[model samples]
Target: MKLKILLFAALCFLSATVIAQTKDSLKTELPQISLSPVPVEVFAGNNGVSFQLIVSKYFKPDSRLGFFNVTQFTGKYDTADQAKNELMSLALISFDIWKGFSLNTGAFIDNYGGFSPTAGIQYLFANKDFLIIALPRFDLARNYNFEAFGLAEYRPMFTKNWGFYIRGQAMYNRNIKQDFLERSYVNLRTGVTYQNFQFGLGYNYDVYGGTFNSNQHSFGVFLRAELF
Candidate 1:
């Protein structure tokens, strides 16, 4: 009930914002789209794949609207511990308010079948060789948790056809009402890039729960490609 109300309110707010902009804006440009088609990471006991899509268009020189989505699925290959298998997704609608800063509203669906409606602020920077994003949000459901996510990637060219790639990503979610950490993770990747593909080594450390927490460390290789 409350989640539905919050979702409705967010949709209304975004619609009003877009309608207001279109009233004064010249024209809407065609959206630019980017996709990562099932990037895979292979680990000793767990293997995972992730898919991402982003679409953005400018309504004015200083303002734009975008949609971002990410889906992750992991499987445990060595054990029957279904708890170690996970599926999660995040989807957001973002509206630029200032330079590299945006207001975002979205939903996060966790592996345990929990759905959280989230409202947040995000900062994004991207160029030919660098990309960075930082987001802090509040969960509108389930004790109103606070969540922060960050990602940074650098791909600098060593020659016309080769480049070095490194990326770091992190996420932390805390149940503020209960005064406990719900989930946290850090992921790192480094390797070389050729054309639109990247081959890399990856490491991830994940912790779940509050005082009696369970953690996991995974090291693996990964392959990623950009599909524009």
Candidate 2:
């Protein structure tokens, strides 16, 4: 756990440099569609090491709404080698409810995680170089109830060809009748973005049932590309 914290700190250090750099006064637009691949390490839960591959897509129909899809495939080895997969999708609608603050809501569905209605808010600060997002949802499925997640990203462009970026995501889930944390997931990453290409190293963790219940941790490297 200590090592994982250190890795997260390293990513944040790169982001800290952005505070000293000049910020872009103009808002930069994103692509209409983007596809990226994320690979991570899987430790514990299973008896041996494993790898998880996720293919994700981001689509924006307009400035106010966006949609996303993620498919995951996992392979592992233990007493018996096995593989599993899941598909999750989301739709978000953005609103300018307050100054420097944005609100969005829609629905999220997953093959294994269950279907859930979700709402979120985002705050952009530090010359628009830093962003924070909070999202919460309730799964309609009988298996689970409430869940909340948040994401933070910091990107600072040093030049036309060089830039640094740090991103972190975490989620907490619980059952309807019970209080206290039930399930959790965390992802932390930091790397350099060169034009449309990105390379990074990070850690991934998932826990089910309780805080220290059945859980898995992984540290690995990932590469992403933006092809509009």
Candidate 3:
């Protein structure tokens, strides 16, 4: 009887140990998510001072599937009517299709385009010195449009705490049915960076109108930083 009681107690202890180990293993295998920082850029040009705020977030439940969202607001203080202000936002579910490409299906919203069911392919590449993103999407709305947007940044370290920063962003949107260019713009910036803050020169060339006759150019200094 004593031997049987000891054996029973030992079996119970073994079972509890195995269950605790399994729980620990499952906890370690669960995916962890972290929030990204928001970045803000302000460019003071010859025409006016413009402010831009960008927020991007990503959630990866596992390795193969993820969710992404990006919202941007850009406004120029040159006009009282807020004629040049723009806001664009995107929410997407991303599937990892290849090494650096993701198949994204989402919705896009902007001031000019309104709400659109968007389908796009996103490519992202980032390393210590360079970051690049390119997305080409079609807006499925009345007066459907095809839009291509790209952003690239290069940073080379001069010291441990300072670096040279250069960035370029461009966007082209065209109406597919009407066969006209809706909007296009090229922006370039070069500056010095200390940690997450940058200060430098900036240039902008913008084209408006369906006929693409109206054009605006601006050159000035800019300050950009990331907010945690």
TM-score per candidate, chains pooled = 0.76, 0.59, 0.75
Instruction: Give the better candidate number (1 or 3) by lDDT.
Output: 3
List clashing residue pairs in candidate 1: none
Q: If both were scored by TM-score, which would come out higher, candidate 2 or candidate 3?
A: 3
Instruction: Assess each prediction's global lDDT (C-alpha) against the native.
Output: 0.69, 0.52, 0.72
Give the per-residue Cα lDDT of candidate 3 at 117.
80
Q: Write the per-residue lDDT of candidate 3 for residues 133-166, one digit (tens) a residue.
A: 7877676565667778888989898998899999
Of the pair 1 and 2, which is ahead by lDDT?
1
Worst lDDT 10-window in candidate 2: 25-34
Give the range where candidate 1 is weakest over 10 consecutive residues by summed lDDT: 29-38
Candidate 2 stretches with Cα past 4 Å from truth are: 1-86, 100-103, 119-128, 140-144, 178-182, 210-213
Give the winner by lDDT.
3
- What TM-score number comes out for model 1? 0.76
Question: For residues 1-228, what per-residue lDDT tens digits would candidate 2 score against the true structure?
Answer: 343335435534543443234234212333322333332323223233333333223333334233332233344554343432324455555443333344445666654456666554434333435655565545433443566767676878899888997888787777654555666678777889787666777777867664335677767666656544
In the range 3-104, model 1's lDDT, one tens digit per residue, is 545754685586567556655442343222233233334333244433333333344443467666656666765566656677777788887654466677
- Candidate 3 local distance difference test against the native: 0.72
Ranking by lDDT: 3, 1, 2
Q: Count of backbone clashes for each model?
A: 0, 0, 0
